[model samples]
Target: METRSLRDDEVMKRKLLIIGWDGASFIALDGLIERGCLPTLARLRANGFSAPLNSTLPPVSAPAWTSFITGKNPGKHGIFQFYEVNPWSPKALGRGQRTHMAVPGVVVNSRSIGEAKFWELMSAAGLRLALINLPMTYPPAPINGLMITGMLTPPGARQFTYPPELAEALPPYEIDLNPREKDFSSPDAQFLRRIRDVLAKRTRVALELFRRERWDCFVVIFTETDRLQHRYWHIVDPRCDASEWAHIEADVVDVYRQLDRALAELVRLAGDEYDVLVLSDHGFGPAAIKRLNFSALAERLQLFVSTGGWERNVRRAFNRISSSKRRIYKYLTPLVPERFLHRAEAGLKTLARRGVKAKLIKLHDYIGGVWINTTEHPGGVIEPGPPYEALRTQLMNRLAAVRDPATGKPIIIDVRRREDVYHGPYTTAAPDIIFILDDEYGIETGGRSSELILRIPQKNQGTHRREGILIMSGRAVRPNVQMARANPTAPGIEDVTATMLYLADVPLPEDLDGRVIEEALDEDFLRRRPIRRCSSSRRPSPDVASEVWESAEEEAEIRERLRELGYLE
Candidate 1:
């Protein structure tokens, strides 16, 4: 066998760096660029090409980010939601929340991911890679190079994995914000100070990583954009009071500007050393609804029945007696993750025990509805199975009936079947049902014992809109790539992997879902175009992330660190 190598000019540059911003909207960027708030990004756009990067349907984070790395859909990757469902067991961990009531070992062993990620592909090419704080990338495994896991990384554990030598070379991990909670509080002076500190430290760490290693390609994802939007979307909306959100709006702008400046610095450093690619997983916008406790909705629909007329009355009496008799059990009962709570009830077993001895209390306070074990009781009325068609019809009717109390306008946008909203063979675990609220229909439920009609009342402003931004600029990239006008261009999160490989002269896996976005390629600098292949035309069987911890002690260490960092607890 003979292998032919390309001449220096024929072979494209091998180095590439990707910086990802989560939930960055083109609408926001257009306004910011006009206001001169993002001079660096504006300058990059002028010389380079940038467009709205379309994200996947349902545009939530976990699946979106997973797709970004793997260049595959949820069907291919099998991470449909925040929780990684155990299809075999038919059990689901809480969404966004990491821990289960089970013992640490059980949860660790039970929870699993659906597929191989970008780093795996990168490793096969024998290229040095560094991943920093990518969401849901914790439980760091050995890769070709360094890995610092991001979201869902367990606390007190060593979230970063690297060559022993590289681990020693990097700076020590310290929680950037002294009081990490300040990161979530209002954008006050304290918040600004913390932001500045983190940005500076981040720059230092990034530069150090770059200088320390002759990395072939470096990919870094920053989630500050998503976090800022989560805390300040209301402030950015013109319809909301400026006074209430004024500070938050300014803070959001500052965060972007800081990121822009950081990017500028990175480009300056990697100017000749690497090709640069900036991207995002998805954009953010105000959610259509403020809040909708599906649990509350199901209860109001009389899905759960009380032998007595009013559930509220029955609960009040039951609570009085139970509190007096079983105060210890009540205190020990695990509460829902919501900040404020109406009642702290026991876990499922305790509840069932109470159902038999005391009174039949029928209620659920969580979203996505409650799991019903039996078909005999009134509680099974809301069960989303068997006659899925009938349930779908009823759900649509109820959604249509939802209206604003003030304006009497319909608030439900669309109720999509799980099959339609989600794309995959594992539709069973995909949302049993999904409700899309109207553009501004905000739902709120908090700290209330009584179940009431779902309606929009006081303004609770914040949402995750469906638009994000993408930019590509390199010797091989064509300037002025046109984005789809109607929506952000459908650059699946996984496509970036193939795109980067195309730029760097690496082969792509045939099984991947996304193509090397050829439209963004730099035309003049290629020896040969990449031979694209799909991971599979048919959805590939799910290949979950590996559970390859060296030992129980190692796992414990990582889990503890994650809990301390608040990534997991």
Candidate 2:
């Protein structure tokens, strides 16, 4: 490709603003637009280049957002899910205490990302930036401008913002919704109120920073959209009876309405001077309610071996006792004094935890990934090479053949081996077998249940889909263009970083997996600023200042939040 280098003044002439709605999907947005609920987004779609943004293979937030910022596939960025098998140790680890073959895995964090982010590249090029609420940004790295860390930030942590002193100046800010404040599985007026409050505070802080901070690039992500969708999809989906959730239906729509207003305000603040790009990491849809016990299926297939049957029996017995306790609690709650409630609850929780003891290969609930007992881990049963490959193939075939007894249709839509789906230096860290369940079915990894599949009422009625929303609007972009016509395959989340770099006139890295979205840019802009590529990729040394969690309790707190949000089992 032809390349050019722009002058310092030329690089400073253009500015870009990226607005992220974490899991906004056109599937639901289209209906809202028609109903006149999201006028700001509707106007952007009509005036700008709009298309469905494809996400990563499993399409979960951790990998998808990492891909969006790095211009790399999950294999290259090294975050396949919210959590993966810890490759270095078999000891019990942080976050949900998830284990496989006696090895506990760690939650994905800033240190987990293997590739450099585009903003880091831009910062190196002397561009100012304001990174707000981006996931996996805890222990904020030094940037040219300012940053406020987002999801996975430890609760009550004082070091969430870069330029540490900046934290004191902003309005009261929250990194994410507090999982302790609300039961996300069921709808409550208090939960909706909290969501609105968080949105308002985040918007207030973002606007304050946008107006006060110096920047060439500004990025802010609103995670409330994804949070609301996960809990309230049943209220919004047309197929579901709205009357069933009538109490919170209007409040749910109002949240989106608030988001629409926030979008309008942000864009209005940008005015006509800045090029704007709006997108999502992945889309949202009605969750599959039928839970498939993947570990149970693996056990039945003889691919996974538990420590012993005694553990299973003990777990089942505990479950029965716990169920009976719940029934008794319902009768006693109104009669008993409130002072003793906390002690009783804590005791019950202890009893439940005592039941789950054995560690084995199992499915991950968030991403539908099956961690295999390969020779890579200590005490692994399946040997590497042909045996590993054969086991993966056998499991994939068996999973694909599984059918729903009532519908007589396959429950799993697709299955793939790790190598076939991902490629890069970090591929070895990924799950052995990844599968996609039908939209009507959800998979569970916990081996607490004896049945392979069960019809259950889920508290979280929404889940992520592959196709997200993308809109590019500004003076430099072509007006009213449909990205699908120019690019047969919709642009993936990985493309956003390259597009941002191109707009900022930074030289593209040779190893990037994305291309500049030329079809969406104006011809004059393209002609005036030709593409430039560097000879080698840049891998900066890890910053010593970007520290991990300070204590185990802090790490555990974040994991509990993820579990409450349904990201962890």
Candidate 3:
């Protein structure tokens, strides 16, 4: 009996699988490959095309991921920072308390984001897509297919957005920031083995679902490379330590090899049944640590009160004051009765209109830019006030003046308005101030935990590097694409969304800030999308600690194996 081969031209079977790895840098990739470690990745590169993937400015995960999904900049998408505004008065928002409440009339969490995300566009076009582990998608929405939230949301939070009739027949799904806790904690050898096992398992689940359910496009992510690099860069660098470095390098190589093997398996399973596209949101690299005290700079400008030990005392005092106020607010909120809350809120809004600023004192010591309340940006209650603009300029100038004592190099390399850094009409409540640290230096503002500052020993031992990689191969991907040609320097991280959407034959939303990379596709490829629709689908279960301890036991074995392999000691 002869068996038919599944091929890309089959037309009958058309789908796309996208795997997003967090912080998989081309810098790390080159090192691993030159050392003869990542054969599978190297082979894949030989068979396809790969280049440095440009990341978002500020080089963080949340904004970059959002841009990748929405094809818009932070200005357009509005998720500028990790924490949102305190929905209640500042007095009510404190540490360990959820700061922002769902403000009435605001359906989406971030006001900066525009509608027309990748899945939404695809679903509306009538194509079924499975989006697994994409970040910032918590509180999962009603989708045409599966929508498992990624890491930023708290664990075990996947709630089904589709109805029971639509969801009942789907495979059980589980999602988390990092799903393999036990294996993650294990040693090198076992960790590698566990990663392989998990990849095999995840791939199997995805394939089975694809075949049984008959979905059009599917995407699953693997973030293991990112996790390993953050903890092991010192070990892998040739210019670093001499004695123990060699052993660590071997372990790092093993991770690359494992990912390569996993890719091979995915390819085998996909078997031309779908077009495969692998990408990293941003690439990885060598980073150094540097602490900067913003309050110290503030003192130089006389904005902050500082004594010999005044900074520590001030932080403690602020924490206490903020805590006391929140507890009182929380207590009064219920006691005053439901009817009074609205009336009080209305009165407060009236007071706000009359220019009665909230009594809460903000030290203005935080590292990020403050939003200047002005007619230019509405919904803002505070402005620089009379002393504001001058004070802001003076402070920005002083921060720019800071330099490394030893090297005499400037600490802040650039300080631009958020509007200047990002381009789009959907601007954020722009930070009143913006400061960029010297490469490898983290802004360690004063009023930080004593443990964070006093405990960490080495300076310039932090992370912050440019030069991430981008790789693309599969249906209609142009061959021999070079990094310089395929990606121009300083490409907005959001461009990935437009590029992917174009590949999937989805129409570009008019408001998107990014343009599709038309040259990246083969000329003969059709841009017309296939017709498909999702009847109903269930959100995957949130990851739970398995009742079966066998996997946990296996994880323990892996950690020990890693110790011997010198990945961790």
Candidate 4:
């Protein structure tokens, strides 16, 4: 209350509602709206200008949503991947240093994040906020108001809420999800019922919180859309269909309708006073996951690791196992430590290898291709001089040239070096090479030993596309405006944090990677309140890095949950 600088009217009028739909893309949303399935979302879009926001480099949830919340790239935020490099444990590197791979697993933590997320800043500024089920936000921190973490949370945990005792009042929250629930191939009644029940429960919890608690900035994220899209992509996706479960076509439609109803209820609860902003981390397309084997390909190029056999077997076995990727990944982590992970190809380089022999550390963001072990690590062989540059150039060419044996089309559509996309202190942690797939043609991230290796699937299922949904509608917004690509201009996920800060009449830090998406706002609104920019020197946990909160048990549990949801490898 002491930080209150606003008048009574301004305090009451400055309310912002943020709703996040994990994996919601404009492509999928437009179809649903046209068919009259998601009328609530349709109306909201009509009220405000919206566009398909460009997702982060990997287009995964952790980095994408974190970018939206922090207005920074993976390099600055240090959340490039989910399971960041955890080379800690004193003995981990024979020192006191500890770390987690920024490659993937959105930094699995059972405790609140060390970084100062936007909500934390708001809390500091004396604004009441409620964050319900936002991904990569586990162990809800103590905010000025209620806060609930999302999919990144481990279930059966009582301390998930800011109050810590909030779960005891509800009908048991469903914080975790598995892949089979959305997997239409083996669709069952119980699984479908469970998914519906879980979503309903979460919605109920959110509704109760909103009514029970007074708040200014409120955010609620629904992640089931992402889980469903990833698993049941075949059924809901217009690009593909199942003649067998053809009866369930409407079931997928019902899911969207369910969400629409929920949105309507929330909007109704908010009345006309609130400005609503709906968005998604990244768009979803048919699964074109290709588990690229940089190790096998490198070995053939005479640049293979000595431990290639062990790593390859781990990957192959993971594919063979019917269990969720969670358990299998846990089984794989202990086999190799992060320090020794940057290994050189055997025989060719014994203590010294020629050129840079690549070995993928792990496919944390499953779709993100092989992360090469280079001179970036303490044990790395690829020196940063001419040798590193020469090897990267060669590897990029070889990977980009990979072709689909069945289609004769190139498997990789683009290739990028780490330095090209990310910058900051953690820049060296990025994968040596990131290769994009030609998802349109059904090229997937296939593994070396998998049956789908170097081949397209019978039907393209789901993959993370760069374009996701971004709808802005509220009192200060223009109506019926569909964003156009007249110029090379498009808002990115990174722009969200600044936009929110702007809407709340708060000044923003200039160090942010994204600029305010001014086009989405009404002209009159902008004229009245010009954007105010500050410096990063004043901005700092939204500064948390180099911490691993989840113990081995918790990491295994959450990883399995992510695997069951098909988010991890």
Candidate 5:
């Protein structure tokens, strides 16, 4: 096994295909595979290396997928979540006085990503590329080959493809399943239908592109997996009552089966010449048994102080009305007029937004981060330095102490200071304190209820986990290898990009947090093509200003989509 440099012909001939199944986990996949339901994946696992890919800190899609493409952590990528706190808003001033209001600044877009994606680096290295339906890729940028943006593309956005004319060449495609059709409270046949339809359209586009595109590397992601698991986990989870959802169980499984077929088709099209890698941004699990209202808990602990004023009174009134409305809707929705109910809901939302002010600590719902209101904001109650550190420490301790009432088990698994987990110039933009909740619990930041802990309903019984699935099989990969057995630390989402770059014979970027997963590669392949490195110091700094949505309507549309997907309340 003599080491040698990859020749130009070898580099040009290397082909890699990445298929991302957002929120896929081995817990579900293994069970399905054992049942022969996902034969393609089963075959892939049997023939090649498989491992659990660790997700980002919060285990959410936005950051995890971004990390996957950039081989960087959330701090380095500058996309902590779907949204971030806007401390500079004039609304924070509130008539020249400090008010306790949380203002979500903007929906994160492609421009928000701080690092160059692997495709960009590969393109610069003279590799032909095809990127399809990759999330956080909205506002598509020019690349070496072609690109089709994925999640967060505003509904009706015309510029979802690069070169502007590629959209015309492709079949009618959707960025994602319409979020509005999701209804977790009941079995939704319509939702299932829409997902299947979307899946079909996506598969068609992917297959068509793969057939026509001439490229060294092609990457495409299917987000419907994450969407289905989020809403229909109850159908698959054995712990949930089967009687109510048993009828739809087969239909749900069929969705996965259809996905399996689609995956097989894609691989068949890729041929033996291409190295195939299938992965997920994060894993899926039973939704938490209880919800932790961070804002309520902070208030209970007195770490979050309300600036008592007329606005506070108004907020209190709004809460009472909102609570009463929920109670009424719970009992009267069947009897009430639909239009009336919709108007009432709209009115309440307006009231809630206008009446509420910021507290000392803001709970960012989408990102699952807690920001300390320091002197930088309008109503900064806590001073920067010692006070900030003390508050964070105290909050972390209190959160760690919380226990589930029914089980008497700790609810929080870990609480970390921002600095402990994140590094880079954008670190300060992150929450001062980041906490990880037990899988049995989910955090609720909307302050919809005063209770610190509320039981989760069965309908909403799935959420993200840290361990996603990764399967690598190709001529260049080792057979029958398990990543965990090969290495103590499992491969992470970030490592996927680095591994792909290495396989494509591109030099690894020096600034990347992820390293090539060498154990999964064939001994001969590694010996013949030694790894290479290049300085990425010329890349843009993470602190470079990010672009925001040009119009309020676009921002609103994205917010609604996130809310429908259960990312926001």
Candidate 6:
């Protein structure tokens, strides 16, 4: 990879350095910061603006990062999931493609987002930019500087790096935790060292790139914070049931301490002239309960009542035999790699399609997109107009009403119609009904083959929370002010771009969904920066000139990875 030698004139422009610490929740770290366990972070916070930035609607990685880069909602960005279900042909489900077998969707990558990334915009404006291991940046888009994509780039693909030869020149990057090892039980000492090992590799790679590259704006995302939280939150989280570990382990704190050192190194590299902003895609917390199944409840509501008796009976008989009300899902799913389970699950969906299409609601593989398959679907029985609306309402209400038998508290945290959240050309790609998950319980959506509603789809130690962390420090930022956490007025992930653009002296785009977080800056800094907003000259991205390349093999790896990470079952 070629390194840029900054010209004397070019070196003086205000530089922006963004460090993405995915899934670092501020709420979960109150004690750690106050106690000085994370000295570098505490120092930065004492001198900078720290706050909780709201995540995307689903509070997941891809969507949150996409929103941050484009300053647009999923409605405008078209990246609702790591993979988006192609809605072109309803009949396309059983087309026998290896990729769709486990996922049945396109990998949401650089090509998939309908809006241009802020880095791309900055590149077009002639500022050099380097985006390192950023999620959804696969098949690296044309940027002025080097671009190394994250896991979505898939394994064994050379195009994952920009200046394509960079792949040939540099060592490989580890973008995710291996789904094969150190699951929830990983907190044991040896596995804890594995966490350090992975983080070390990332820090080494990032430092090499940061030193060897030249750019006005640079971004690097560290995911160990998020992955460790998923696998070992019990060690650090106060809300977790594993209180025994409070005294037994400090791996969580040690892991964060390593990050603090890594961050301190980056701050030093950035120098006094550059502004550094640290943030996460989503927050993290202990997951006490999983979502309950509501397929049986929907069935009882006559949502599945169709004209055919035999198809319904055959499907019901199969479901009854298989449904231990999810006993199989709870005990068996963890024993196998999630890919085989999805293949089995997809095979069941294929089998169900052979009989009558008796199911009204269908889960796409595990708990991704939920479809109604009402009158809109081919050869469907549910009527379209008044009947469909009523059914959707009933399903939402019933799903919201589901509660833990023991706890008596509602299992759902939020319920929404796809229409309510999304408004764009690719709206159909979204699940018709969206379940905002509760940390307490997991949800299992019934497919055309499934019979019972209540079952355990998957398990994890932690889950995504709505509030991620943001700490911006520079001579221009205010000292020691915390951005309101859980307050409705806090900035969304999308605001990241607008704020950056403002700092870079680029005209703020008025059309974006985000507002500049003026509060995060010093009053004198604001006066010096003098915020300005103009009608956006930007337009939607051009359609892909070529179909984005995808590997069925890589797609399977991603599916297994997502399942292991608890984003999917």
Which predicted model would earn the best TM-score?
5
Clashes of each: 40, 0, 27, 46, 5, 8
lDDT of 1 by residue, 79-164 (tens): 64444333223232222111111111212211244555666766776878877767766566677778666654544445345554
Candidate 3 regions with alpha-carbon error over 4 angstroms: 1-14, 85-114, 158-201, 213-215, 236-245, 272-274, 305-391, 423-426, 446-455, 458-466, 484-490, 523-569
TM-score of each: 0.73, 0.84, 0.67, 0.80, 0.85, 0.81
What tens digits encode model 3's per-residue C-alpha lDDT throughout 1-569? 12332343245334676777677766566667787777756665666556666766545555667778778776666554333322232322232111111111111222224445678877877888776667666546667877655544343332432333423454554443243443245565665555555555555555565554545667767656555655565655455553754665565566667677767666666665555666776654455345554434433434322222544555555547545745755778777764465455333323323221111112111123433334333243435556556655666676678676666888678766656777654354335555666544554432322222222333212133444655666666666665652345534456667766666656566666666554555556644333222232212321112131124344344334332322222
TM-score ranking from best candidate downward: 5, 2, 6, 4, 1, 3
Give residue 510's error in model 1 in angstroms. 3.5
Q: Which lDDT values do the candidates have, in the order given? A: 0.55, 0.75, 0.51, 0.65, 0.75, 0.67
Candidate 2 off by > 4 Å: 1-13, 86-88, 91-104, 185-187, 304-366, 483-488, 538-547
Cα TM-score of candidate 6: 0.81
User: Any residue pairs clashing in model 2, and if so which?
Assistant: none
Q: Considering lDDT, where higher is better, how would the candidates rank from best to worst?
A: 5, 2, 6, 4, 1, 3
Overall local distance difference test of candidate 6? 0.67
Q: List model 2 lDDT by residue over 381-405, tens digit each.
A: 6678898778778777877898876
The lowest-lDDT stretch of 10 consecutive residues in candidate 5 is 91-100
1-569: candidate 6 lDDT, tens digit per residue: 12342342234246888999888888667767876877878888878998888887667788889888888888777777665644323322343321112223544567877876788668767888878878988878678888888856565565777888877776656655567653555545666677788788778877888887556788999887877777667777765567666664576788888998899898888888788899889887766444444444344434433223565565666578466736766777779765566567655434444322123222222233345555565545557778767767876777678666766776666678888877765566566677654555544543332333344433556767778988889876788887667877787888888888777766677777777788887786676456667676446654422255565576676666666554543
lDDT of 2 at 412: 79
- As for TM-score, the candidate ahead, 1 or 5, is 5
Better of 2 and 6 by lDDT: 2
Model 4, stretches more than 4 Å misplaced? 1-13, 85-107, 110-115, 178-186, 289-295, 305-356, 361-379, 440-460, 484-488, 537-547
Candidate 4, which ten residues in sequence have the lowest lDDT sum? 91-100
